[model samples]
Target: MLISLSRVIKGYLLSALLGVVIGSLIGMSRTINELLLPMITVIRQIPMIAWIPLIILWCGIGEESKVVIIVLAAFFPILVNAESGIAQTPESFLEVARLYKLGWWKTFSKVYLPHAIPQILVGLKLGLGVSWMAVVASELIAATSGIGYRMSNARSLMRPDIVIVCMLVIGIVGILMDKAIGIIFELFTPWVEKKRRD
Candidate 1:
């Protein structure tokens, strides 16, 4: 369980960071977005589990394969949401930044980032969920240790109680991770909460 949780956390964080950066760049560049969108759409249409066989062949039935699967599963929703968030930045905000003669970095940090926070958080939440699912699936197929592996072993022995226990652990851990992200989101975007109240 701990091993699986670690994989999910690490994969989720890295994928979220990469997705946001790449998505922001693409969102800010119409030509790049247009060039990449079709390919991205095609890749996203492929189910995460479907990649398992190829990932195993490429990475072996090891921790690396599980992590790779988790990362891939977590990446796409984040990329899509981050791109949409940046693209949806208000024109008024851009106009104000231009009027202030803000540099690109300043404009992005002050205007674009704040405007995109909610959507980014939404993406992160979705990514985290997918990461959990991916890690479990990967573990069931390939791992030597993890909640999924334990459950699989229990199934062979017909130990339904152990399987149930593993399921509960996964569920609890997932809820904790999600709540932790929610707390961080609220902490970073207090102004959004305040505005909502007003």
Candidate 2:
């Protein structure tokens, strides 16, 4: 369980960082969006599992393969949400930034990022869920250790109790991960929370 959790965290962080950067670039650049959007859409349409075999072939059945699978699983939703969020930034906010004669960096930091926080949080939450699911699936098919591997082994040994225990562990861990993200989101976006309460 610990192994799987670590892998999930690592994969989630990597994918989330890359997703945000790439998504922001896509949102900011019409030419890049036009060039890459269709390809991204097509890739996102493919099932996560369908890539398992190819991932295994390329990365082998090691930890790398599993991590890659989790990254792929978590990447698309995050990218989509982040891009959408940035794109949806109010024109009024941009106008205000322009009126202030803010540089591109200042405009993005003070205006775009603040406005996009809520949607980015949503994407992170979704990405976390997908990361957990992907890590478990990858472990089940390829890992020698981890909660999923333990459950797989238990199934082969006819120990339903072990499988059930593993499932519970996974569920509890997932909940904790999500709650952690929520807390971080609130911390970073206190204004949003305040508005909601009002």
Candidate 3:
């Protein structure tokens, strides 16, 4: 279980970091969005399972492949949400920044980034939910360690009990992770939550 959790965390962090950076770029720049969005859309159309064969071929069903699969699974949700949040920054806010004679960096920091924080948190939650699924799927397909591997091994040995235990554990852990993200959202974007009461 610990092994699986560690691997998932590693992959999730990598995907989140990359997704935020690239998504920010795309959201902030029309040229970058035009260049990347179509290709990204096309790739997103492909199902996760469909990539398994090619991934196995390239990454050879090892730890690398598992992490890659998790990254792929988690990336789009985060990237899309981040882009939406940043790109949808109100023109009024931009105008205010302009009136204040704020530089581009200051404008983004003071205007766009704060507006996007809630959306970014939402994306992170979604990404984390899928990360667990991706790690399990990838591990089931090919892994010598982790809870998924243990479950697969148990199944081969006809141990339904072990399989059930693994599923329950995964569920519990996933819920805990989701709660953690919620706490982060509350801590980081308390104003957004407060606005809900109005």
CA lDDT, every model vs. true structure: 0.89, 0.90, 0.90
Lowest summed lDDT across 10 adjacent residues in model 1 is found at: 21-30
Point out where model 3 deviates above 4 Å: none
- Residue-level lDDT tens digits of model 1 in 18-70: 88998887877889898988898999999999999999999998778888898
List the candidate 2 regions with Cα displacement exceeding 4 Å: none
> How large is the C-alpha RMSD of every model relative to the true structure?
1.1, 1.0, 1.4
Q: Candidate 2 lDDT, tens digit per residue, 145-175?
A: 8888998999999999999999888889899
Winner of 1 and 3 under TM-score: 1
Worst 10 residues of 3 by lDDT: 47-56
TM-scores of all candidate predictions against the true structure = 0.96, 0.97, 0.94
Residue range with the least summed lDDT across 10 consecutive positions in model 2: 21-30
* Candidate 3 Cα lDDT to native: 0.90
Clashes of each: 0, 0, 0
The segments of candidate 1 whose C-alpha lies over 4 angstroms from its true place after superposition are none
Between candidates 2 and 3, name the one with more favorable TM-score: 2
Provide the lDDT at 70 for model 1. Answer: 88
